[model samples]
Target: MKLSPTFLSRIPALFLSCCLLLAFGCSDSQDAVEPTLDMDSKANNKSANMMKEYWVEINPLNHSGVTGQAKLVVEGNVLTVEVWAEGLEAGMPHPQHIHGFVENKGNATCPPPSADVNGDGLIDLGEGVPFYGPVLVSLTPFPTAEDGTIHYKQTFMLGMGDMIAYQALKPLQNRVIVLHGMTVEGTYWPTLPIACGQIMPGNSMGMGNR
Candidate 1:
């Protein structure tokens, strides 16, 4: 084939233009992919910041026959708590609380009958403290049992102290819910631990009574 000098001399420029077009096409494709990756990262961060929920299955302690369930939800700096129980002393105020150890010092749990160190045959508040830790959040304006049942719900804004305690309560499996007050006629009856439940993750469905 015979070609003119002018046409042959322009071949390098034509090749250069094709290379530039390919480079630009590849750059534009990469640029398009980056935004999708960025959007995925943002979506994951939003999910990580969403709300979490926990549940507890309250069981009778000290033979008081009190049983209950509790739900706790955490969203940002807000916490919502709900507790439902029966077999409480009718017409008597029962103080309930979320209990956990500070700084992971000990494992939180529901005290067994063997926790009654004084041979009193009843696990009182002091006896249960070692297993359940100190009261972290007092669920108050303490609910009074109406017709031998208690239904309680409250929401709280995490204050400095509460936030600190909540940080300790992270992985809430080691925390507990304790209901105080019993029908026994005694000086320590009001502070007796009638029901106790360990906090577990997730909703209450299929959770066996403990």
Candidate 2:
């Protein structure tokens, strides 16, 4: 009718062990709930859908020196502008970019890099509006040599939507497309828009219009 000393001693150790196990068990359970990327499953399901597709038809206005078509694709914030020229030679940088609220081709110069029209210091929504001008995202200058056929592509993420969306919307409201010109000491211009087009929106791809 008496508990053994060994048994009594073992009860406390057993209870302590159980408590430790429960604590660790709950901690492990919580850790498992943390988010984790199912990369394998995603990789299996991933297809062309991840790739963005867009088509922009650019034409020159009030100028005969430059003309052509440009295609673009937006994956997230990065924009890839591809130029397909008819009579353009090879080796030109093209000096191209997106201007916010641009009125005319010869009205202003390409927005200088790190330019903040709103003086907000941060290139966020509404910063590139007041200037309301074109920005040189990327360019393919006049062919350095003679290729006879101009075809160049460039990628850029100028933080436009994140900074100049409001200003960009105005120009975009009227089928604005990509514009190309020249660059001189980060301040070239008359950006004689050589190639131009209207950005058309489709089901899978198109301009955000803002």
Candidate 3:
């Protein structure tokens, strides 16, 4: 038997392809055996149950006269986020954010009533943010109702940059959501956090509570 130069050259390429395929297969096999998102584990990072819900109701801090709730839910590959409130300044655009856990050590808690250490009034956003780290996602604003009710809704992708935040959210027994008032001098109150919510597993809170 005589082997051609071309056949000899092809042998190396073929061998490399087989090796690469074998490596890929081994990696995938290992990954397949691993667990997926754990919905109940505080240590896990992701959860997917179609309509599984997690949210929190935030009381008025800083005496801004605002109260509302933030809800995070999964419908598909996107997370349906909603922040709704009443008692906020009418026609005001509030800046809201999904704050991370405090240093990723544990769940972020809403500042206790005693957090108002100054004895002036309420617990403002500045004082509250430290407990909840930076914004994970700043949602787009929806129109505020004429009656002083503000609503913000946004859907975030669960497969990209948002995936990191979405995954981290599952472990948090507490979620810190902040809404920044428009200006220093609001229609009724000064520019501050009109409303904030400490979200967890639950249904959307009705306006009656705000």
The number of the candidate with the highest TM-score is 1
lDDT score, candidate 3? 0.54
lDDT of 1: 0.67
lDDT of each: 0.67, 0.39, 0.54
Ranking, TM-score, top scorer first:
1, 3, 2
Write one digit per residue (lDDT tens) for candidate 3, span 1-210: 123355336344532332343244233333333244455675343334346777677677656677777677765446788777778666544456555552343666656667666766656544655665545544544343457786667777743432333344444455577665533442322224555676677665653353
On the 0 to 100 scale, the lDDT of residue 74 in model 1 is 77
Q: How far in Å is the alpha carbon of 145 misplaced in model 2?
A: 7.3
Please provide TM-scores, in order, for all candidate models, with all chains considered together. Answer: 0.71, 0.40, 0.60
lDDT of 1 at 66: 86
> Per-residue lDDT for 11-96 in model 1, tens only?
44532332343344233323323222132577646644678888988999988888889998976446788999999988665667
Error of 2 at 156 (Å): 2.8
**Model 3 weakest 10-residue run by lDDT:** 25-34
Tens-digit per-residue lDDT, 71-146, candidate 2: 6665543456666665432333333444433334223222232544455432321232233233423243323224
| Per-model RMSD to reference | 28.6, 24.8, 18.5
